[model samples]
Target: MSFERLNQINDYRQLGNTNLYVSPFCLGTMSFGTDWGWGADRAESYRMFSLYVERGGNFIDTANHYTNGTSETFLGEFIGNLRDRLIVGTHYSVFTQRGDANSSEDRLRKMVQSLETSLRRLRTDYIDIYWIHHWVFGTPIEDVMRVLDQVVRSGKILYVGVSNTPAWKIAQGNAIAQLRGWSPFIGVQVEYNLINRMAERDIIPMANDLQMGFVATSPLAGGILTGKYNQLALARQISVSEMLARIDCTTARASLNQEIGRLNLHNLAISLELMEIARQIDRSPAQVALNWLLQQSDITSTILGARTSQQLEENLGSVEFQLDMTQIADVDAINPTDSGMLYGDTVYSEVQDILLESARVVDLNH
Candidate 1:
């Protein structure tokens, strides 16, 4: 709130338990291309990339399927000479090959093929971090780990990360890798934000326990946390529901609407509280929301996505200030998951007490 302008971007933080360092925020390139009709053109994308690099941002995230491959191609051009200085991370397991049913398979063959294509598109010899885009139900965890380990051994990818996977599965895979002396996943990417605290129930804790880096995607809740929908609707003199109805029925937009529709009364109340806090602090709602994520101890870095330079600059300002304990508690109080009896802190604490009390008891005979 009313934070002094950051002369530059925040200092680098270690990526998980790895020696590699990345900025406080990773530049997400999902909107780097205009194929989606809602993203930045090549020139605007280049400008955003230049500004981020100029401000000392070195970590950039992109998926092979992002924008039909334009995102990776554009990033390849933008990072020309700076390749050595930046930590380039890209994901796989999403089909980009047209009319290839087998391409969707996350087997060793598909993984290799996908990595090869990503390397060619990015114009790089190796990816700093390679992520499995999502978990495939039929694939064996051992096979995935073995292939990932082989990729690391081949010097094709420096590290492996998993995204959109269940906590127990990742734990099992990593344990297997440890026993086999294979490369374990060093990072985790997941949808994490004020509204989507579901990750906190398991994913976040699992990553912390395993010493894996946690990267939060959709930290803005698909722009809802920015309060843009309400502002845009108000500007057009329409109700929120009416504005949402006017959105194009593209697959991406529909998915976003589905996520927003999940917002119950508690979420709306939290949004209002967030807006009030932003007002009291004299900061933009987006900045306040992002700052809260950056302040989280479990988050190694929060991914920031923007289609324009102004939006990117505003997101960059998030790292400039700290949210005090009072502000954090205020926001925490309205969190959607905090009210649940099964998952709330109250029950967790009680369970911990019971476990600790049981641990302290021992029979003299034993």
Candidate 2:
């Protein structure tokens, strides 16, 4: 699709700060290369990129080690001179095997230098948001913050975001930065889905309190909530083994399977439920999953990853409609995450148990 066609995908939402407007869904390019198997081929990647941009999706997420820098290389060519149109976030601190170590002081300088290299590869002078991909060893929190501040001040990076960091640790970093008068993180990125709500115990509340943006990655739980694999599983030709082999068996998938088995006698029952919900809402299962994330107060953007334009379009449908209170309640009743069920909130849990037991009884009879 051309840029004009892609711009028609305009769905915008306000971030914590009113000045920054972001699309409800941000495209994650971690699957741009073939490192972990299964990614967009070059043509497909270009199509997805163009379609996303045309659809008014300006935020893009990527990492240095994704598919061995194939992601960045592809993005460099993909974005071309239109880099200024996208709010790009590229990560680091995950892979360093090819480089040498540095002293404490040099480490901070080196980290900035590494980001500069990333900028070069990305064919951009500045990154809208720079994320510390993962926590690394031997790097002090203070050093990391100090260098990050320097980069922002230098205009190499406009804002700093942290991904895969503990809630308490992130809180500590921000607190230190605040007390010492340094730039604190404006946003956080983490794995969140209906099945994996562990982050809610602390991350959600903390982010809300601090007014930090929360970006949910893997909102579909590694395609489990997409209803694709479940559809295949129903035929008995494609087992969970096939899914594991294809998608690396994410925590989301494991939890989904366990929960589905615990809830219904057969997994197809849950897929049928999702499919029914999708039909009722006039959206796809993937869209319903993404929409669920958008319903949260603290959730700023959902990072959607797809290896094809078709997949991207499917996920984008999530931004189409707001779920009614009844629909939201129905979904919550089935998938109770830790945060959704507070100590006194036992109504939904009780309902889930009754329904599960009833289904089990019926299955036994059959």
| Candidate 2: residue pairs that collide | 6-54, 6-55, 7-54, 9-55
lDDT of 1 by residue, 18-79 (tens): 98889878999999998976799999999899989998899999998899899999999999
List lDDT for all candidates, in order: 0.78, 0.70
Q: Could you tell me which residue pairs clash in candidate 1?
A: none
TM-score of 1: 0.85
lDDT of 1: 0.78
Tell how far residue 273 is off in model 2, in angstroms: 3.8
The top-ranked prediction according to lDDT is 1
Give the number of the best model, judged by TM-score.
1
lDDT of 2 by residue, 234-339 (tens): 5666665564345434543355455444222233445557767888867887777677677765678889888778888877776667777677777665656544
Using Cα atoms with residue i matched to residue i, what is each candidate's TM-score against the true structure?
0.85, 0.78
